[model samples]
Target chain A: MFEHFPQRVLVNEVVTRDGFQSEAEFVPTATKIELINALSTQGLNKIEVTSFVSPRAVPNLRDAEEVVTALNRNTDTTYVALVPNERGCGRALALDLDEINLVMSVSETHNLANMRMTCAQSLDQFARISAMTAGSAMRLNGSLATAFGCPFEGLQTEDTVLHYIEAYLEQGLHSITLADTTGMAVPNQVYSLCRAVRARWPDLEVTLHFHNTRGLGLSNVLAALAAGMNQFDASLGGLGGCPFAPGATGNICTEDLVHMLAEMQLDCGVDLAGLLTQSRQLEAIVGHPLPGQINKAGLRTDTRPVPESVTQLRQSLEA
Target chain B: MFEHFPQRVLVNEVVTRDGFQSEAEFVPTATKIELINALSTQGLNKIEVTSFVSPRAVPNLRDAEEVVTALNRNTDTTYVALVPNERGCGRALALDLDEINLVMSVSETHNLANMRMTCAQSLDQFARISAMTAGSAMRLNGSLATAFGCPFEGLQTEDTVLHYIEAYLEQGLHSITLADTTGMAVPNQVYSLCRAVRARWPDLEVTLHFHNTRGLGLSNVLAALAAGMNQFDASLGGLGGCPFAPGATGNICTEDLVHMLAEMQLDCGVDLAGLLTQSRQLEAIVGHPLPGQINKAGLRTDTRPVPESVTQLRQSLEA
Candidate 1:
């Protein structure tokens, strides 16, 4: 059934940044470093480490600089940081980050709500940031937040999203991430938008970041895959939600995603058992049960012990 | 994107049987009747009202007879009951049910664990029941439990499943349900099995019953849809779990499923808002939060009240 699918898909783990930023309690910088170092060993090619945002705006990630600076960077993994503006860009560049992920909302309302800037204003900032890194070795990836839907504006048109992509491309940022910020994307919408985006920019490295808020996260993954997307962003333990959107849930669980892909015989280089172990440590640090299903329910390959009743019944029948 | 898909899909609400049977608390027969009656008006074409099983095994559904007898059935809806054996068949036949749904496992270990009978013994029972109901006006639909994968047996081969299907066909049962009893099915498996089954039995009405145990429930639904299978079984608020399988979660949320189908412009003939309201009531009665995502996230059409920060940011930007 998946004979036509790519042999291997690229997965970028975004837990340290996306997952931790939404937490009510600050995850200690030491703990963040520990998690990132652990994730690096799990065969993940990319890990979003931290966000260089204002301390007051997101107190939970106030230790972003400390966490990034103290990380035991793995040579095989690219450690990226979320840089919302030129200020964030400067901070991340000073830290010698592998990649600076700049984000802007495709929806006008969401851009203002999230970054306190208009879409045009955010794009102008991104252009300035692009110019600043022109002669540098820094790689930039732009994320179009609410590319699928917005909490304030509801559904977004494909033209609206493509306009933002056009702006990002004009700024010389080739790698793009389409985010379903409000988790409102259905499979058809995912398929249609992804197909259109890939068609328009055939060379653009498209990555899908989906939220499981409406239980359509993995379904959207399948849709995006069918539409020819190869890169995806997922968080450990399904941690992370839109701080601006009330009741929005986390990104698709990284362990859960790997489990499904492995079950389908798709190559997702990460180790599922290792990710679950990390997820367990994360659950301990977070002091709660995670929203991830695979971590809670063992992998399909792990068999359950036969119940005593079944054993007794089998013996009785044999007798 | 859905140009090649069927215009409408059939959904059978299994809340009364699948959902209630898993609850620790015995919901009153009157309440069960009220819920079933409410479901009948929600544009659902089929509803599995109850399971006529040994009350000792599923004490929560002890009042199945009373609940089935008291329902206000809609003429457009088919009221079905789960009949595990000939005794349950007699009880369901006495009530003049629209459909008598017989279930058995495709995996040997799961059959022993769940039904305390061998695969052959279950088939023999089904054949006897089929013979008994031959001259009657009742319709029989067979459910191949763990058709996708078994918790005890891990995964069942397509040939193993097809062998069971042949037996059901030989017993004169036309309509069949392929149940993912332990939520172990992935999209590739669901797509391949469903397509193959439909190909072999062109006249058979195929229904897919999936669990959200590992969060692939709705994704499997999409895969089955692509494979030409239409009918699905979903529970309200995702309330249901296998009693034998530890850590197995509920069936795919009926409200969540409807919400996705409606958003995709697929015809399900179900009211999403009404189902959410009923789900809310079910949560209250169950005295706990349900496993559904849509009920908590609200519908995509719902406009969230602007966060104070967003409102203030907009005003400052305007200034």
Candidate 2:
């Protein structure tokens, strides 16, 4: 089973766009730029810098253009952004972005609730964006939120996700992300679904976005890895959460994912120490402690000295 | 891969014993007894009620004998307690404990730190306890703390654990627990070690103890499960952390573990809602939010109604 792992995995950072959007108090554009600049140089494969959504809908990310424009973008890191409609996609295309993540939900109820549009309507939006972006160098990622299980609906079958993937392919998108928008995925469910997705589209690039709401995020990551998934979406300092799913936490922490990957001896290519430093900075910027555990508990190799009290007790016992 | 799972995994609850032992405020004896009584009836396979160590050392569980004597223990649940030496074993033998966990550390430094003794000395104590428990029905579980990793030392190899386990069998101990004392375990290490342990001793009732320090607790559980492990030790409300490992959190949460298992459709045989209730009550008793996520996040199936805001937005869009 350990042999099943690839030589390396790709970790796509989504903190600036997905993480910051969830915060009610808007982060300053400069701080967003500074954070992205710091993280981009840390060997991350990709960074979703900002979103081109309506300012009225997501006011926090109103400075999408400014953040992307002001970025001290690293050459090695691919820059990405989330786009919800034709206008958003057009905004993303105008920028020097490497990828545009078009978002939707497989569950009709979730699609209606999250996007205020039916699944069919969202597909139409995607089709229009794809038609306009034809022959463009910018990549497109069709992110299916609640691909695992929906809060409004229940568990989603692999077939349900595949059905959405079919539509995604029909719209000319080559890459897709199965987002556990509410952290409703279990290990076997993720393994089976990821296996099914790979079996259907061997050439497709699949990224898994998980929430630690129920604390199964990393476990689901392992399941995905077993089923030949090498791409993941994580947030720095464990930022961003599903506002509709009251109890759901944020995206899986970027530093912690890197730490786990490093421990497993899989090459994630991210500088974990740099990520942890940024996570600490993120805490100060967010004005609250984030959900990441590795930042709290240092690396496994970081061995602590035996406490003075324990040493004295041991000495006394020996005496 | 899914077919490798057992019909049901045996979850051993260790809140009252391991969790409360780390609490700064000593829980009142009655509260400890009440919590134990409440949890014993919740379909748990076993419950480690308390530690029979010197009251002066673990002041929180000073009323170990009293708590054990007073428990309204259910017939269906096997009652367990941690016992370190001859005296603690003697104390447990006088009570109604179904199993007495003989604790030790596979690493030399940890044994000296935690038990104020060397590994050899701890083994000698276990031998003495084994001699005393001869002809007794009370089962003994050799718990190898730092079996996965040590805080003062570092990552422990499976060989070191196997060496200690071999000694345990020599002392007539049939069951063993591989404790990740500082939550340093990764999935491959866990899977590899668990596979090694199972291969060496097929019939040994192996129980895995994990911590969420690095946030790989459940991920490690998935590894152990893949390695054919069916017994896990979890703390209610995610109580009981590594005192030596500064930022490390508590044990793998009982409710969260059960939630993941139930989601995988693996029979954990735990009452989820009942555990949630106890976890909430525990929070009130401990006077703080616990490290557990399920209590804060709720189960995946415990979906919320579509928010009135989302509904209004959808309605306005439709109109």
Error of 2 at A235 (Å): 0.4
Stretches off by above 4 angstroms in model 1 are A1-3, A244-248, B1-3, B244-248, B305-319
Worst 10 residues of 2 chain B by lDDT: B241-250
lDDT of 2 by residue, B185-295 (tens): 999999899989899999999999999889999999989998999999999988987875665588999999999999888998899999999999999999987888888
**What's model 2's lDDT at B161?**
84
Error of 1 at A9 (Å): 0.6
Clash list (residue pairs), candidate 1:
none
Count backbone overlaps in model 2.
0
What's the i-RMS of each model?
A: 2.4, 2.5
Write model 2 residue lDDT over A1-319, tens digit each, in one string. 5556668899999999889998989899999999999998899989999889899998999999999988887889989999989988889888879999999999878888888888999999999999989888988899999998888788888788999999999999969999999888888999899888888889898899998888888998898998889999999988888775555578999988999999888998888989988999999999987888888888989988777877787678679
- In model 2 chain A, which range of ten residues has the least summed lDDT? A241-250
